[model samples]
Target: METTPAPAAPARRRRSRAPFPVTVTQMPMATCQVCGRALAHRKGEVSAILTAHYERDHPELLGR
Candidate 1:
């Protein structure tokens, strides 16, 4: 008696997980409001550098 070959195994179906949504907040770089010049700051604090630049470049605005 001839035996029939075993049926082929079913192909594996891979399950994928949905990607998670992420929220991000970015801080803008400091710039001189008068001349539009780029300013540098340390640890996200730019007031000192910005103030110095303004005082040097646009001294007239300091009184106001």
Candidate 2:
């Protein structure tokens, strides 16, 4: 009697990879807490900017 051929092995499934995208973020800006107004410069700004702001708005606090 003739014998039947064996069955072939099953194919392996491919795995999917996760995709990554580039992202950008903004930095916090400097602001005055006294009047709750935005500052002209960013964080770590020069003292002159602060002095000018105070002299202009809070001159009384400066005590000339």
Candidate 3:
């Protein structure tokens, strides 16, 4: 008698994934209250700069 052949195996499938989420923010800059001028000082130098600016640019206000 004759024999028959065997059957073949099935193929496998691949998986897919998504990327992560992200968020961004920005801080506000400092400005002079009197004339609305911009300042370029560091963290703790605003007060001194404002005081000097007021004294030199606005000496009349010192009387008050």
Say which candidate scores most in TM-score: 1
lDDT of 3 by residue, 2-39 (tens): 98877776877665656577775543456777788876
Model 3's alpha-carbon lDDT is 0.72
Candidate 1 local Cα displacement, residue 63, angstroms: 2.8
Name the lDDT of candidate 1.
0.79
lDDT of 2 by residue, 4-63 (tens): 999988998876976688786554555776897776565566466778888999988889
Ranking by lDDT: 1, 2, 3
Error of 3 at 47 (Å): 0.6
Kindly give the number of clashing pairs for every candidate.
0, 0, 0
Candidate-wise lDDT, in order: 0.79, 0.75, 0.72
Q: Which model is ahead, 1 or 3, in terms of lDDT? A: 1
Q: Give the alpha carbon lDDT tens digit for every residue of 1-55 in model 1.
A: 9999999999998779777998865655787867888865676578878877878
Q: How far off is residue 35 in model 1, in Å?
A: 0.6
Q: Which residue segments of model 1 deviate by more than 4 Å? A: 1-28
How do these models rank on TM-score, best leading?
Answer: 1, 3, 2
* Runs in model 2 lying further than 4 Å from the true structure: 1-28, 42-44
